[model samples]
Target: MRLSGERLVEYGEKGGCFVKKMTADDIKDIRELRELLEVGALKILFSKNNKQTIKELELICEDFTSMVEKGYYGGACEADVKFHEKIIEATGNERLLQIYHNSNIPLFHLKLGNALSHMDDYKQTDVEHRRIVDYLKNGKLKESIDTLLEHLDRGEKESIEF
Candidate 1:
């Protein structure tokens, strides 16, 4: 796991495995990597077909909003992952998608449960997700990426504090 760059786990030479504690720095590092991959994918997505992609993301945004409004944070997290994954998938680069999956970015929500515990943040997340989809539909790549970074940064802050 160490050789593969899995930060969540560590295997001791004494023949035991342990769950590695996540520090604030570790969360920050993961957030930075996520930003890089997601921003790069968004740039690539702009060069390709986005009509279908926009619709898919819009549907996800709706679901995410509904989940948040209903106070189902777990479901919201899943929808959040779907929304971001759709953006990455629209890039049409299999390797990029694979790297995103391997990075386990989706697990952050679970790992930092307190991050999404606030209703205010949930509402903000919904609004941000809708804005991202709208920006993409309007051919505003820069705005979409900017909103994405803002969204990720908010989560990172909450995670670190938690």
Candidate 2:
């Protein structure tokens, strides 16, 4: 919420646009946010740590995949949003969830418009999601963090037409 889309465009117009090279603290904050998003995206996309949630997310992913296959990108975008929301909710981190829900979450979902437009590239994201979840399952926090960063960067890139 700190920066608007028009503000971002203004920065681009002035050639000051970039997600900017993330600083250590920036990266730390983003990594924290990404962890929450990845957890949600993966939990909803592939279902991990809990069977019921997994089944539910699998069904949603299947439906969203079908929609994507049929060229209904909006639904895919919505499912992606729901996916992330579920993860944030699962975390029980109210403050983090607020940031995600109010700002980054919408931006991320918006990027899915581009990602779904280029399904092949986005497919890498899907696989990355699963990998992140696998890392979480195995208790590899660092690996999960790395993959989550990659996942977020990919979305950030695509969001700006990368």
Candidate 3:
């Protein structure tokens, strides 16, 4: 049972994160919802909500930067995918998660070896991520969000200038 004031941090670590073993009580079914959302994102239907998408991405990058700054490589997956999962959550894209859960993960993990080699870039990434978070927390949501999306795009291309 979840006790009062149970923080997620207690379930994991201060800097490094882990996948907690789960039971049926912790699971929820969302196959259809995820399929629908994935299809929408893939088809670019969410293009209309571009601004919202950007802000969410910023939040993601901030988390990545934080973990890296703490001297941890982050999580079980590539930095980009792990970071994007955070973005997906902030977007409240329930359906999109399904797609991540079912497909994107494998594709991303396949390239994780290369991503691990880029761990040294964590320091720079951390600064960029922190800037994004400051923008969001300080009401510069639009600018921060745009920066976030651009950061992700750059990471995907492995040509991140910032």
Candidate 4:
């Protein structure tokens, strides 16, 4: 059965049938799987004609940046999830999208929120996200991939510390 967005949020906040507190190993596995999926999604995104998707991504990035600037960490995290989910959708790969949807997105968001709450300077995040958008928009595949990797790496480290 598919989960509604509200249900997913419930799972993330309160735990449910498909949600549980992640162990260190589970976190590691999730990180690895996320990296693999994102890399594949990026490759697919690069090959596709996605002008609309790029525009949407740009808007989301701007929204996220604004949220960060206003000290709205929760809003920023929501925008962050939407940005990544949009990338996954832009891949135009049904299986990849399904995998990401089934993966515990709410839990990932919770971890991300925790990490972001601990950070004082969100400028790095804003810059990196903008760079990813620029790289993708300009067809710089390698640079986009590298920036995405670095962003994910930093996220993983922050999550682990939380």
Model 1 off-target regions past 4 Å? 1-5, 11-18, 113-115
Cα misplacement distance, residue 42 of candidate 1 (Å)? 0.7
Tell me how far candidate 3 lies from the true structure as C-alpha RMSD in angstroms.
12.5
Quick one: best TM-score, which candidate? 1
Name the 10 consecutive residues with the lowest summed lDDT in model 4: 1-10
lDDT of candidate 3 at residue 47, scale 0 to 100 = 39
Best by the lDDT measure? 1
Predict model 3's lDDT versus the native: 0.47
Give the higher-lDDT candidate: 1 or 3.
1
* Per-residue lDDT of model 2, residues 82-125, tens digit only: 65566566555587678776655456455545444777754665
Question: What is the alpha-carbon lDDT of model 2 when measured against the actual structure?
Answer: 0.58
Least lDDT summed over 10 consecutive residues: which range in candidate 3?
A: 22-31
- Who is ahead in TM-score, 1 or 3? 1
Q: Give per-model TM-scores.
A: 0.87, 0.58, 0.44, 0.81
lDDT per residue for candidate 1 within 1-162, as digits (tens), equals 653376667788997877677789888988998899999998998878579888989899889888878888888878888888888889999999999878877676465643457888778888998998788889898998999999999989988776
True lDDT of residue 41, candidate 2: 50
Instruction: Report clash pairs, candidate 2.
Output: 40-87
Q: What would the per-residue lDDT of candidate 4 be over residues 62-106, giving only the tens digit for each residue?
A: 998888888888888888788888989998789888888788764
As for TM-score, the candidate ahead, 1 or 4, is 1
Candidate 2 vs candidate 4: which has greater lDDT? 4
Assess candidate 2 and give its TM-score to the true structure: 0.58
